[model samples]
Structure formats: C-alpha cells, structure tokens
Target: MIFYNGDLWGPMREETNSWFSRIYSARYAACTAEEGHRNLVLTMAMDLSSKTGKELELPIDVNDLMKGL
Candidate 1:
C-alpha cells in the first residue's frame, strides 16, 4: 500500500514561521515544488501540516498521472 510519512517540516526562511517550498520526507525521495504550485504531493503535505482540528480532504486522484508510470 502507498503511504506518506506525516512528519512535515521545512527550512524556515531564516527565522520566519513560513516554510520554504521543500517539505521533508522520511522516505528520502527529496521532493521539491515551485512556489505556489499546489501539486498533489504538496497538497498532501500541507494537509498533514494543518492543526485546525478539521476533517481531512479526500486523497488526490493520480490515476491518469500514474498510468504513464
């Protein structure tokens, strides 16, 4: 089964609370993202980072993207 390590951390902008575009992955794939581009992986990371005590969103549909893989 596919899963993600939810310990989301990032390099803070030199003392700022905001995270840079890189989210740490325990699986060591070293994922990266362009600024403001909400790719599926990043969306999952941000959802895991949330602490607002709300229900999570549904999983992203990567079927089409995965077809070529």
Candidate 2:
C-alpha cells in the first residue's frame, strides 16, 4: 500500500502464501483483507522489536483498526 494518513501503517506483504500461519495459527484463517492487513502490521511491529530489542506492543484486533476514521 501507498503511504498516507492512515491509522494502521506498516510494510505490506503479499499474503499469497501462509507466512503467518506458523505463529498466528488459526487466527489467520477466514481473515478478511482488512484483518490480514492488521496481522501484517502487528507482525511488522513484532519484527521491529525483535531486530531493535525495543519491545513494541501491537494490537491484533480489528477494534483498533481505523477507529480514527
């Protein structure tokens, strides 16, 4: 996705494969594009924390998605 004034922003990965199925498991099932998008954002946050060791908290629920809009 292109950059803009969006609430949930992160590096978007094409989910043509089961990238998160290992860690996220069943939660990755039946996910709307929106939910999968949210999972990717959280995954990015977690990855950043792992790389930087800066401990980041990411929400995985749609309730936190685009509430600003």
Candidate 3:
C-alpha cells in the first residue's frame, strides 16, 4: 500500500498479494523500474517548461486538479 515516486508502486502488500491488487498498478503497468528510472532522469534533466518552447497550459480547472478534488 506504500506510494512511490509520482504514481509508482512496488514490492508487495503481502505474500499472496500481486501488483494487480493495488490501486496504482494501472498507471505503472507499462513502466518498469529501469524505464521509470531512466525517464526520471530525463524528466530531471529538463527545466520546467524550458524544453517545451512555450508555457505549459492547464487543461483543466485548478480547483479540480486532483482525481477526486
């Protein structure tokens, strides 16, 4: 049940518990440790909005930023 970087999760909740049992599994399904780690480095390599060339735009409401907010 522990939360990892951003929306990542690892290890198991119990001996019989698989990753599919967790709520965040779907988000990290395609992201492996190596890939995620590499992407992490790439993400840190960029300055916020610097590589994008233009300012990032908000696609949704500020008050509704979160999944359940």
Candidate 4:
C-alpha cells in the first residue's frame, strides 16, 4: 500500500488558455505532477509483480527512476 500526502491542487486545477492560469497560479499549485508520475510507475511495478506472482523490490533509486520523466 502507498500513502501520498502531497498536494494535488496543481494537477486538479482546471486548465485554461487565458488569464486563469495567472489568476490561480499560486492559489492552486503543488508537486502533485511529480508525485503522480512516481505513483504511476510504482503502481505499474506492483501490478506486474502480482501478475508474475513474484515479490517486487524497488531496487532502483527513486531519483534515478524519476530522471527519465
């Protein structure tokens, strides 16, 4: 199980083509994009491990895993 406490405000904020971006820039901003990306990779890894009936050890450094993104 994974627990995430980071802010999702940035990713949840509605996208726009005009001044709304600037208007809510600071009000709706967080590190959710990066956190979501990491969670996606981890979820995939867990799914694959379960499908193969094998224990999954995350041997790779998280920073290294995130570098490609």
Whole-model lDDT values for every prediction: 0.41, 0.54, 0.45, 0.56
| Stretch of 10 with least lDDT, candidate 3 | 60-69
The digit string of per-residue lDDT tens for model 4 on 1-69 reads 222585234532444323356556656544366875677779766666667777667854556444433
lDDT of 4 at 23: 57
- Could you tell which candidate, 1 or 3, scores higher by TM-score? 3
What are the models' TM-scores? 0.20, 0.41, 0.29, 0.40
lDDT tens readout by residue for model 1, 1-69: 222484434543332322332323334223345433346555554545464445444443445323423
Of 1 and 2, which scores higher on TM-score?
Answer: 2
The CA lDDT at 7 in model 2 is 38
Lowest lDDT block of 10, candidate 1 = 15-24
Candidate with best TM-score: 2
Tens digits of per-residue lDDT for model 3 on 1-61? 5666745445434522544554345544455777766664444333334644544343333
As for candidate 1, its clashing pairs are none
State the TM-score for model 1.
Answer: 0.20
lDDT of 4 at 44: 64
Q: Candidate 2's residue-wise lDDT over 1-69, tens digit each? A: 544664323454344335555436655356677877877777766665666777544563434333321
Q: Work out candidate 4's RMSD over C-alphas.
A: 11.0
